[model samples]
Target: MKATILVAEDDRNLRRVLRAMLVREGYDVAEAPDGEAASAWLAERRADALITDIRMPKMDGLALFRHVRERHPDVPVIFITAYGTIGDAVEAIRSGAFDYISKPFDEAELLRVVGNAVRTSAVSVREGAGGEETGGWFGMVGCSPAWREIRKVIEKAAASPLSVMIMGETGTGKELVARAIHGISRRGKGPFIKINGAAIPPALWEAEVFGYEKGAFTGAVTSKPGRFELADEGTFFLDEIGDVPLSMQAKLLRVLQDRAFERVGGVKTLTADVRFICASNRDLRKETGKGRFREDLYYRVNGIPVHLPSLRARREDILPLADYFLARSCAEMGIAGRKLSRETAEILERYPWPGNIRELENAVGRAVALSEGEEITPPDLCIALADTEEEEATPEEMRFHESVRDHKRAIILRAIRKSGGSKTKAAEMLGLQPTYLSRLIRILKVEG
Candidate 1:
């Protein structure tokens, strides 16, 4: 089947040039004078790929790219921009544009990029038709046996009404797994409320979890519903469950056991048909032994424990995950047609992702941002796998002496400085929830 390519360029001559080139290459070509028209065309017809200019009349390339990503994940995109910068190219790739070409680009180069994009689009369609679930079940993507086994367990767990405990290293996608189970369960239509257990400070734990009555405490101007109440007949994902305070754990336990909870200052008791799914990077057993985590709560949440595999443990899945991340990152950034070079793939597969999936995702995003060309390289990733080759370089004693708190302080300060005092940007750089970063900043006493 001939691939259909949509060309959106305000420049009439360039649009003709692109359309002519693609049509001559045996592709069914569609042209729109601007992004708005292109987006309209996209709404009706299925285009294998999109070729758009960075600048357009009503809508720009970035905006169009976002539209395509949200509506058409299967169609690959190629961007053509005269004002291309390293930053622009990086942004394009990170946004999920299939590829970017500078103005006055060689016809050969354009053809090559388009060919690749078309091929990718075809592959996506084929996979979707083959029932591969490229987006995976509920946006989780993995093909490894480990992942399959985990999915089977999640499937079984989803069938029941039992509480589930997810165990994994930070960034191993524990919440994603929880969501997958929720999405497949009987309560799929219900709200999936996620709360970071650590983000809620000690004083606000009750107000946040159980909510408060009007004028219950200082600044409690109105009655508010808690996460549990909001997640009625849904799934409540308590992330970083290990960080939940011992006192709060008992309250959570009561809700789990009785399926009933009371507002902070309300006399009336509320009932919720909510499912509990807890996740923790820390070993709850160790926390229980240390008298940090409640034993009863631990036993209750661990009704059907599911473990997520780290990237290093599932090495065979690294490349696939990398590709998925790359695609997602680019799509989100409104850039498309970016690809990993063979060498980059090797670097990613060989690196032991200590930070696991989260780390790998950050690495891929960094690579896409840093890489200038169509292909991402090792240097583009900017990942220093020191432990990979020099595991013994740092002495255990020296490592042990390093203060984690001090190290974290330094890192936070660096991110703050680099982002020019923007907490939002710093949070993005650190891959942290902005609220969580704000809490850390206050707790760590970071100066503005």
Candidate 2:
């Protein structure tokens, strides 16, 4: 069956043109002269996608898009706007609109975005009722094969009694993985305590991981149960284990082996009934080989290694992750959830996320707070785009014998193409000022 596209525009000429174009592309077209008409049409039936002007008679695209997201989340909505309403359109995109096309947009571009919206709508059919499959496995989200395989590994590892080590880059949700293991294990009902090895001072690691005696030091006025004691008969997560000092590693190793420790400045030995789950962005084996980490400690915490793929390595999860972040941020900030445009999604997927999921979450939160309208646009996510431009290199540029000049020129060309020939947008995408992009275009003799 041909996908049905509803076009809601007050401008008769633009509506007719869009209908004619969609029809030529073999789509069944529905026309709405205003937001009111579009809402009325939606009341009776559904279209695969919606394209509405930001400003329409009786109602507006922003309101209509919100209505659709609430009532028919699977039906993607796109906005049509003039230059004056670009900001409003962007806000709509962040709020949940599928995408938007500016006035005088290329017919090809329109068709491309509409096609994406239609494809997204079909994909939603498989996403169940929540617009995502967040299986009942500890708040973990993503439908990628890597994520699925990781879930299986987590379940198997959780069922075991051996200590587990989670390895991944910073912001790769290692802590979440640890919590998931704890939540699924037999000790799920017990306390799940965590300590950041990197955050605690080397001198205080002992006192923090083990109980401290009263008057242990000048500031020790009272005895306190350490992280391990707090997590007795439960799970203890040591994050950034690679950052733990060599001296502390020996003490930690002793506790893991003996399952006992003495309070600081006290002779009474205490046994801890705790499960260990260690995490680190660094390679523990390499650290041990370098004589910076204890070999014995490394082996003790690495009984089962669970490595998480970075966001860049699992590009398929980017959009779902973004949506998850947006929803969470919106809820936390008391704002409505936003959606990503296909164009924005493409940019996110193309970018190499060096900082991983943590970075993505921060970026989404920033976008949500800064976005003035319903949807998030490219500008709203420019901080991440800037980071991507600085650290990421394209395949063509990474090849041997690729000259510096050629790489620079290629970057400029790609940015321009990605920005649809808008120098300002291209500059933003490239993390360069508009004047710099123009200068480079002139110097490279590239057609702008």
Per-prediction TM-score to the true structure, in the order listed: 0.60, 0.58
- Identify the candidate with maximal lDDT: 2
lDDT of each: 0.74, 0.75
Model 2 TM-score (2 dp)? 0.58
lDDT, candidate 2, 1-448, per-residue tens? 5788989999999989999999999999999998889988987666999999988878888888877866676688888878788768655553446566767676765776687667657634421122312333565678899999899999999999999999988777787788789878999888676666765667767876785786787545445556676777789888778888888888899889978998898898899888999988888899988999888888899999999998888889888888887887787568976887776777788878777876676667767755667878765665334322334666875552234345456556666787788888776554455786677778657764
Per-residue alpha-carbon lDDT of candidate 1 for residues 1-448, written as tens digits (9 for 90 to 100): 4778999999999888888888888999999998899999987678988998887889988889888877786677778866435346435553345556666676765775677567656544432111112375666667889988988999999998989998887667776688788878999877776656765566667876787786686545446566677777788888778878887889888999998888988999999889999888789999999999899998999999998778788887888878887997787566766999887787788778887876776778766654568898655663223223345446774563244344456667777888898888777666565887888778657664
Highest TM-score model number: 1
Candidate 1 achieves a global lDDT of 0.74
